[model samples]
Target chain A: MATAADITHIACVVYPGYDALDLAGALEPLTMLSSNVPFQFYVVGPSLEPVTTKVNASVVKTVSPSFGQSIAPTHTYDNPPEKIDFLIIPGGMMFLDPIERQQPTIDFVKKTYPKVKYVLSVCTGSVILAQAGILDGKRATSNKACWAWVMENCPNVNWVAKARWVVDGNVWTTSGVAAGMDGMFAWITQIYGEAAATVAANVIEYDRHTDASWDPFSDAWRTTDPDHGKSVQPKFTE
Target chain B: MATAADITHIACVVYPGYDALDLAGALEPLTMLSSNVPFQFYVVGPSLEPVTTKVNASVVKTVSPSFGQSIAPTHTYDNPPEKIDFLIIPGGMMFLDPIERQQPTIDFVKKTYPKVKYVLSVCTGSVILAQAGILDGKRATSNKACWAWVMENCPNVNWVAKARWVVDGNVWTTSGVAAGMDGMFAWITQIYGEAAATVAANVIEYDRHTDASWDPFSDAWRTTDPDHGKSVQPKFTE
Candidate 1:
């Protein structure tokens, strides 16, 4: 029976080509703690219409790029919550989409960051934060598969290539899609308490990569001169 | 340019209180292969309206039970796809939800299972399959937190207690939410070949639990007599 004031409004910015797992993985832990903490989660997009998650490629002759999931946004950029305590940003094939199509979300991130108590980004989502100048000097990370492109796009940002997730002040940035789950769990432990984080992880039966500095994929992917979608190399034999 | 015949129609059943991670974790890998396979994903519910993902608790005075995420169903049980190659069933608080509210989905599963080339159940999703009689005399696994309740409800099915995921013929059942990711990757490896799965896992930066029998959470939760939502035990320190 908590009032609206007691609720921590956590909003996630989404758009077409945003990764579904990146958004779902990070937010899943927060939803687990909703009993004690009235975490009212909101998915904000450019509009109220359903936005497609990232697809590997366009379907032949289809009017729209069909994805595994289409997430419905509760709030539009024009109608976000009064205040967002925690802001999550997930990246996907956003780089491929025209910058004009991405500008609204980038603007929203910049506008929302100052008011947000904590900010987190998953995968190439740090690129959006970087584009918004939030990661200008902050330590962050992104998907190693698109490492060069993320770096090339956001030159002002300080990117860490070898960490699973990086926490600097109130901002947390995870390496890639599934790594967001680990980062969110870590955030839950720090913010909600250790017990809450433990429960969240255990309920999902998630075997987390506990060591932040020990990211193997970063090492595995770096062995080759990376291409756009060249995700794994021969070194990933394990 | 894949024709209609070249596509593999994957249909996921979503109802009220379905786990977001359970659905997302299992489907992300399949979406990664959309380029080569044209794996079209279809979310089917009782109706065309939006379906809420599982929430930890209800908000006071709210008309509708709000969750972190809501999935929009492209198809309904009344109007399903002509053919479905893969059928994914994800679980959450469906146990608490009324059987009548769940009956439609259970009925849909029973009707669709025979035609589906491959069937997957994540977490307590096995319970639905069990309810639908699809798991009759077949070996399966489910979320360890609700082990007793699931076992009691589905006495006929041979429930495996120590598997991250179990595969018997064309049917697959995962231990819990995140465990579905491992199960899906394994399915991809077996069905699509090893190279595709390797790329999918690496791209998401998911370090998989390769061994099917290597489930630590099963042992972690088994230590305590399971409560409804008793997710983790003290032995989960690692």
Candidate 2:
């Protein structure tokens, strides 16, 4: 059992054009867990330089001319900590770009996944995990707005269309940006118990969606892709 | 009417021990508005040094012994831009501290409020606005968890308990951390129109609380202060 004294190190993977909310929403609840569970959060990127998001480009331009909010990473992929208990990856417009363009991030995820205790992805972050071949045979989900895109690109995973969050073994994936909070709260509940999760949510006054299956977004944003209902066989069925 | 060419510069006030969600939740939706409306966001702090939050102390300690996630502020209070169109203030645990302790931030609020066209506050951020004498004759709301503390401290403002967000002229205030998203969405609707607001919410897959009067948290965390019901007369009642 993890006690208050046992520190859990969570590495939040960030990159340029990443969705700020995907990382922020998940961090909000996770941060609230600090009082009961001693933990650390490291904003890891490809480098220690300031990273930009998809939003506030004009503001970000003033500071870095290239990045958005000027978030300085504590550690780079090359200099990550020896141990990472939790790995969180957030998605953004960059997710739609070619996989080769994000080779460094995908490589980091592949190298780090086996050592981490748990893996979590927000929005299209699952796409990155899929590209890394981690979610090969896992049941996962992605942002509802981009569900069809994921279904078309990753044909090796059993992607569920109706779920706020899908937890297959140690890997957890959420739907869209705000849904990351629900997934993080649910993940906390699994690790820290319902009481701890409840306390964390209460601190932020967040009415967390406790039900993993209660996702209304999948239907709200209907994907016309005929393959949307098709279940792709897992390549690594364990 | 504001066009895409009309830029709105938003100065987000941040500090050590600040609530990550208060600023993040608001920024998520506001940032989404950038594609349709040109806006710039500046993370302002006392200096360019990293600001710490209450959570993930161990991880934050690894990077900087003094702060949590290292947020590199683009501008300082002293070196702020000449024109700030919008002002955003977020709250955290240290909100209840003596006003004298945060004199610089309070002083900045007092000095900047008049120049900004819109002033938005999240959670106990209203306390800072109140302390700055900006909410003197205006209506506002804050995090229900710290409702009594705010009421006791800022007795000169007309504080509304049953509101997710309160809009008095150009100033907007939200209930808690997550509620800032709702407030930002509402603010967008007011400025950019319903279609724009809807697009922003849909992108995040966020089901925003559209009604300003739709807050149940105020009752859930009700305070027993006798002066809770007393509506303080606004000192700058227009």
The most accurate candidate by TM-score is 1
* TM-score of structure candidate 1: 0.89
Candidate 2 deviant stretches above 4 angstroms: A1-7, A55-67, A224-238, B1-7, B54-67, B96-98, B224-238
Candidate 1 residue runs with Cα over 4 Å from true position? A1-7, A54-64, A223-238, B1-7, B54-65, B223-238
TM-score of chain A of each: 0.86, 0.85
Q: Which candidate is the best by lDDT?
A: 1
Q: Clashing residue pairs, candidate 2?
A: A40-B59, A52-A68
Q: Is the docking of candidate 2 incorrect, acceptable, medium or high quality?
A: acceptable
Scored against the native two-chain complex, candidate 2 gets a DockQ of: 0.31
Give per-residue lDDT, candidate 2, residue A93. Answer: 61
Residue lDDT tens for model 2, A155-174: 99999888889988889999
DockQ of 1: 0.41
